[model samples]
Target: MNATDPLLTVEDLNVRFPTRQGVIEAVRGTSFSVGRERVGIVGESGSGKSMTGRAILRLVRPPGEVSARRIDFMGEDLLSLSEREMRRIRGHRISMVMQDPKFSLNPVIRVGEQISEAYRLHTRASRRAARQKTLEMLEAVQIRDPERVYQTFPHEVSGGMGQRIMIAMMLIPDPDLLIADEPTSALDVTVQMRVLAILDKLVQERGMGLIFISHDLNLVSSFCDRVIIMYGGRIVETCRAAELDKAEHPYTRGLLAALPRLDQPQARLDVLERDPAWLKEQSVVAHV
Candidate 1:
């Protein structure tokens, strides 16, 4: 792909769910473009970050609705594709690593077999070739004993190991874009660093676009090339990662203030005061 070409372009995206209480707008008119670079979506719970990722894959189930003026991927309209076509693209071209590995992985299958299945489904590889590829993927994710981990079941492995296996499975097909929804949130700090390093290496080496959805402000600022701050089902602010500390929007500022700082230690961090008007305000996109 050309450097100027966008890998994915989402415009006027909206997600809604009907409930007896009321209709909940999970995401509202969100627009963004991602090239072969890391884009971070940061926000608290119920900010619709995860929903946006799922919508790209058309994963939102019934009772939930996803509408977009255009959800284009590599010049093709994703919203227009049939379910079968979308499935062909989902893992082979665009993959997602969900937050919890326990729920994502198949417990009945062996780790290596599951990974090999993903490869076989996307390619014309034989079972032997797929198994070999799966082993390589396990090593790529820094799995110490790929041979041993290959035979182990999901429940038999540690949380960190299971998470790594999930990543290896997602990347086995060498997707063009990877939407990682809080992939590191469940791991300890040390394991989180390891997982991030593996993701960073793969993204850089393969030149793949990444949508990293997370609530960790500091992690996003340091790890992503650009950041999108979501609030009340909309994007409130967007800026270069380096300039995150200098964010201007009140919601972004409030989020930054809430982060505990070692340099400016506080007995208690200030709670974010939500403004109803923010939901109506347009997204402020600041150039670094």
Candidate 2:
């Protein structure tokens, strides 16, 4: 693939779940592309932000349907790949950092061992080499005293440390694209900044594409190069992060208005007024 070409291209992606009430669409006709840049997908809870990420990885489980016109990654059509073929792509070529390390981490395993296992799985490296690589990765994420942290179990580490460990584990194989779903949401402000800095540094150094999914509009606008605003399972607006304030869609405007600005303090933040028409409106396709 050309350097100018996108790392991943998703078109007409849809995720649905059948329930007793009806077939609920979690993601509807969402289309976008990611180059070697950070792209943020922002919206309220249940707006399909996480589902979109999962859909790209084909992680939506049975009973939940995922269909797309095309999901091209690195000049290969992901939708056409077999289950075994996709497994090779998942962690070795693409990695996903889930929201909570508490649920994602192995409770019974040592942190360092788990990270080493990830590296060995894809590269078939020797145990000694994998351990050395894991230690280096932990340090890369700004974890002090990697040796001590390596011996500790998941439950023994602090939330911030656990998050850093998760990032280290996912990045060990050096994936070309990373889909981070609210990776820093559970941490404090200081820790959140630290994690974001680590992610930003890695992306720049590796020249990899990133899809950052979050609900914090201000954070996304500041950290990402481009922003895709979603509402009711569809993209309502797409623009440069610096141009988020000038978004024309009613849903995007309402979301921005609801944020509490330090400079412009108000008696009460505005409530987001939803419109039924937004669900039926055509999704705004993101070019980058």
Candidate topping lDDT? 1
Per-residue lDDT of candidate 1, residues 1-288 (tens digit): 797579999999999999999999999888999999999999999999999999999999998999999999998999999999999999889999998965788889998999999999989799999989999999999999899999998989988888889999999999999999999987899998988998999999999999999999889999999999998889888899988888887778878887887788663445545553554464588853
TM-scores for all candidates? 0.96, 0.95
TM-score of 2: 0.95
RMSD (Cα, Å) for all candidates, in order, is 1.6, 1.8
CA shift at 247, candidate 1, in angstroms?
0.7
Residue ranges of candidate 1 with Cα displaced over 4 Å: 267-277
Clashing residue pairs for model 1: none
- List where candidate 2 sits over 4 angstroms from the true fold: 265-288
Which 10-residue window of candidate 1 scores lowest in summed lDDT?
Answer: 267-276
